[model samples]
Target chain A: MNFFACENLSAGYGRKEVLKNITLSFEKGRIASVIGPNGSGKSTLLKCMGRLLKPSAGCVYLDGRSISSMTDSAIARSVGILPQSPSAPGDIPVHCLVAYGRNPHKKALSSFTKEDRETVEWAMHATGLQDKRFLRLGQLSGGERQRAWIAMALAQRPQILLLDEPTTYLDIHHQFEVLELLEKLNTSCGLTVVMVMHDLNLASKFSGRLIAMKDGQVLLDGCAEEVLTEENIFDIFRVKSRIVDMDGSRAAMYMGVA
Target chain B: MREITDSDAKRRLMTGAAGLMLLAAGFVVSVITGTVDISVGDMARIFTGVQTDGMYHVLMNIRLPRIITGAFVGVNLALSGAILQAVLKNPLADPGIVGVTAGAGLFAMAVMILLPSFTHLVPPAAFIGAFVTSLVIYFLAYDGGAHPLRLILAGVALAAFLGAFMSSLTVLYSDRVQGTVNWMAGSLSGKSWIHVKMILPYTLLGLFGAGIGARYLNILMLGDDVARGLGLSVERVKFMLTMLAALLAASAVSVAGLLGFVGLIVPHITRLIIGSDNRFLIPFSAVFGGIIVIFADTAARVVFAPYELPVGVVMAFVGAPFFLYLLSRSSRS
Candidate 1:
């Protein structure tokens, strides 16, 4: 069964409709990657799906229930979102930033329970941030900061995680590290993952499913092998590419001789 | 990265302890100094409502009211600055700097000049003016609920306008300007128990609002987009903090005139000394501010004796240079 579904949902900011009538569903325990060129409304779509942005029309259903009827905390508990470039003001400790993820689970005057501490520790461990937990965020490198943010989202312990360009600022090694960590979480915890990526190859390699968006609408949605086609690439991104079978896997390598 | 040395932690603890002790000392010192200097023993007796000739009147009336007013002014100003910094997401966005204090001061001046008999109406009028001015700034700065330049620009414009109006009022009505000069310039002199009584309620309310809102402010300092993803109602938090900040500022202005720098500098100082956790910063900033203003008032009185300078002037004299140094250092960083 689908864990979350968006039906004919249109969303935007004040008179500018960024996301057109688009429909999609995230299944349980699957890595779904949304990929498109610039201005594809990829981030907007993730925001809408994550319930960060209210849809202009239609509805989002979580476990077959209307998302609009749910409280913010409830939605937050179910879906964790990490937007591109999540920045806190000067020198927030890594542990404190991660602790904020537990805010949804906490009430006023209540201390962090044993489970909360364990989850926080688990999140730190998963993100490879255990040793740096006490360090200030500003003192960390870009990749480290990004990992700290991911650790914060992980601490939310949500069933679904939505990331908008999570690998943007990282080096290639760190990008793969983060992606690998995310993949492990999806596999081990049965957590449904949705992420937006600019690198078509990375998306194809990491995600089980691919969603291609163009101008606030979903253009294609299928398995990575099926959707990463030459025709789809040309039609969606206006890029000339050849889909070659490389070592029993489909690879779309761009050619200058279009 | 520098090591988290044992001395570093010890030094921090020592500084925190010193800051607290200084605040307590300031309070005691403020209680003792007045037209007639009170001994520590007599001042203690006065608190118990015991009668003594020389120091008793000073303790009961002059010094006590001034001390309370100074403490309230300090706390209100600091919290106002802290709240504005959090709401506007800029360290320089103190209520005074953003024209809220000027707006309140101008309105209070107009009230005294035109509607002198309605003295009770001054604080409310000043509050309304401050709120309206800040609201205008907020709207102008907001584009789909996020405004960066508009707040600073609108604040500058409103502050200029109110400042000009105050000057114009002083120019147009010179006779009414004497009381206006002293009041607008800010003085604790001639303050009575009634003034203390009037300010206590507003100060208490502002403190309560700030205490409740501090956690939200800490969340907000994570920037707007992150704050939203963290399930903070960003717009709501900003609105609530803005209101609370303006209320605190307006009340402070109404009581102590335009005591500068307490609002502008104390929060940054607190941030530099400790981490920017509002839970600790807010109350500590309140204390630091209270101490600064009380000492400033004391200096204002004692430095020139009977020809006492306004406490606001004393604050500006000390704060402006410190603020500039901070500005230069921050810019370099």
Candidate 2:
């Protein structure tokens, strides 16, 4: 039973249908990545599931309930989203940025509670940012800032965390650092992690399941071994590929020509 | 939560206290010193229901009302600028620059110049004008999304377009434009108790609105997608804040006659000291707003004694240089 699912979801920007009648579901405690070339509706599908964009013709269910029927606060409490380029004031300290994640759990005019501070501290500790809580965003390195953002998402303590291109601007080492952090969170805290990634090899290596899209539709879905086949790579990316087996996973390497 | 000593919070509170003290000092200085210097003792006696000197009429009827009205107008303008800056996600967004206050200026000018018989309708008319102009800018700037640059451009265009109407009114009714010159230049010369009463409701509303809206403003600076991820109703908050800021600017323009730069400079200065948090920024801006205007208005009254200058002129002269100096310093830092 797919509790967190998108049922025949179709969505798009004005005059352009980007996500065509695609159904996708993510199981609890599993790490999944949606991979596709530019404009293949990878980010669009993630947005629909996260409820940032309302589906035009279908429903997204969060734990057996239609997200459309749920209020934004209700969904926010269950799922946290980190956008492609999330920015805060450069002058704001890391801890303040993380503290804002408690907004969903706050009441109007109420002071930050004891529980809120503890959650923020836990999130900081989890992301190894407790030492740099006083550091401003402008003062942090690229990987530190990205980790700070992840710490903010983690502060919400949501069951499922959605990220869109969370490593787009990071170096390779930092990219591995973020994915490894997510992997750790999945195992340790049972966070169902879903992300939209452009790096096919990284997506396949980091995630247990890979969902591939092309032309606004999901064309392949399975373990990386099943989804990274040569035929599937060409169908989704219009590129020939050789699937290489790593130590315990697979990485699809692009070949010059078919 | 047992509130612990967060040094940041404590320092912020101290900054707020300092702003309040400055405002209090400003009020006393603004009230007692003039062509007729009502001593501090005499001023206290009048408040305590004691027999007072001849300056009592001038104190109650002239200085107190002007000071109060100026204080609230300052509050209105500064709060409006702070809100607009956050709402537009631009540091430079101000009521005068973004065209919100110019809309109020146009309508208030119409009432004063053309509809001279209905002079009392100026304040409400200004609010209507500001509301309509903000709506126009909102729609014109919004295309699939409202970028900060587009919104600023739309505001500039509409402000200029509305400015043309104001100039035409002045030229067409040149014969009746006698007494409004000081007002057009943004003065508080003849502002009385009635003016104070006229701007009170909007000032209170703005303070209340800014208080509640501060939370949303901080989240909004996170961008629409991130703010939405936090469960905020982004579109609704944006529209509400735009309207609130417009009301604030309109209220000030209704009384002070298109005072410019207070919103832009005051909030930016306050942010340098208070950080980007809106909760403290709003009240701090209000206090500093009152301080700057009161001091500037006093200087306008006293420096060129016996001949009053428009407070707007004084503000422009002082604000422009100070703002640039701060800008240079902040960029280096």
Candidate 3:
């Protein structure tokens, strides 16, 4: 079943609409990556899905219910979103940061329950941050800090997690490490993952499904082999690219400008 | 995998206990040391109901009320600063930055000048001015939401505007200049039990509200978008917290006449010692703030002897340099 979907969505910063009549949906446990050039509204679309941005038109639904009608805590329990370049206050330890994700599960005056502790531990362990849990976020490298943020989101224990440009500013190894972590979470825990990816090759390599957007519309949406075709790459990104199959995954190697 | 551990909680509790002790010491010192120099023996005799004529008058009528007022004002201002810093997510954000102090000062001055017959209404009037100024800054800073930088900018702008108007009033009413200047310099001079009574309800209400909202403040420090993703009603929480902070600052201003630096410095020092968890930060800041103000007020009363400097003057002399030092240290780090 489609656990999440947006219908006839339009959104923008001001008067200029960046997303126009965009409709999309995702099945319960699938991993979907949104790939597009800089100005193609990929982040905007993710923001709309995360309820960070209210759409100018149309509604986002979770489990066939309009998300706008749900309480903030209810939506948070079902959907977790990490925007690009997420930041915490100065020198906050990883454990403390991760513990914040349990905010929705706890009451205003209540202490952390046994279940809250267990969930935070599980989140920290899942992100391979158990060893670094006590370290301040500022003390970690770029990749470790990213994992710390991911752990924070995981502590929310949402049915679906959405990340925008999660791997930006990371070295290639750290980038793959983050994607692999997400893939593991997707397969092992049945967590639905949606992320915006600028690297077409990595998006195709890791994501089970890819949606290519251009000019505020979906140019192509399918498996990597279907969506990362030479013509689609040229059409969407205005870049000439060759698609090579490495193992079973398709890798888009860009040649030059189209 | 890692828990908060027993030691961390114990450490925080110990810190709080120590802070309370220091506050007690400061309160005692404030009551004891003045231009007339009452001894500990005199204070003990007075408390034990000996009621020596001169000492009784001095302790009950003058010193005790000032000390109580100073302590409460410190707590109010410091807690307000802590809340503002957390809600705005800017360390530099304070009651002074957001025009609460200036607004209160302006209204209080206007009352002193224009409505001298209704001098009793000054505290409430100052509160009204403070709330209105904060609301103006909140709305002006808001495009769709109140960004920290915009709030700070709007506050600075409004504070300057209010300051100009206050200066004009002071200049025009030269005959009233002495009283107005003392208040503008943030004096706690000649306060009676009536002044303490005036601010008590507001201080209690503001402190209670701030204590309840402390947890939400922790979430707010994580940034607005993250707080929303964590299921916090960001805008509503921000609005309520800002209003609470304004109430705290306004109450302090009304009683103490705009004691500066206690709010800004106390929170930073508390955060440094106990860490940034608002639950602990708020209470610790309250105690430490009380300590600082009690000491500062005592120094103000005794330092120049008969002349009597305003506690605000003493605070500025100390706090301005400390603020600059903190700014440089933070930038370097």
List of chain A TM-scores, every candidate: 0.95, 0.97, 0.98
Flag the better candidate by DockQ, 1 or 3: 3
Ranking by DockQ: 3, 2, 1
Candidate with the greatest lDDT versus the true structure: 3
Is candidate 1 or 3 superior in lDDT?
3
Worst 10 contiguous positions by lDDT, candidate 3 chain B: B1-10
lDDT of each: 0.82, 0.86, 0.88
RMSD of each: 2.6, 2.7, 1.9
Best by DockQ: 3
Question: Model 1: per-residue lDDT, tens digit, A1-258?
Answer: 797999999988889998899889889999999998888889988888877788899888899999789876677778889989887864677887898888777664577799989989999998899888878888888888888998888888888989999899789998888899889888888889999999888888889899999999889999878899888898888888988777655678897435
Candidate 3 residues B66-129, lDDT tens each? Answer: 9888888888999999999998887877898778888898899999998778877877888888
Q: List the pairs of residues colliding in candidate 3.
A: none
- Give TM-scores for every candidate, taking all chains together and pairing residue i with residue i: 0.93, 0.94, 0.96
* Model 1 agreement with the true structure over B1-333: per-residue lDDT tens digits: 235534445656776788889987987887877567677887778778776776677677778788888888888899999888877778877876556777888888899888878877776777777767777777777776746467788788878888899889888888887766666677887788887887788788887888888877888887766666666777877877887887788778777776778898999898888768787678778888888888999889888887899999998899899899988998998
For model 2, residues B1-333, the per-residue Cα lDDT tens digits are 113226667878898888889888998999898999888888898888694567888899999999999888899999999999998887877886556677777888888887889977877787788778887888899875666788888988998899899889879888988856766778888789999998899889999999999998999999888888888878778888888988888778878886878999999989988788898889899889989999989998999999999998899898789778867886897
| Candidate 3 structure lDDT | 0.88
lDDT against true structure, model 1: 0.82
The residue-level lDDT of candidate 3 at B41 comes to 89
lDDT of 2 at A52: 83
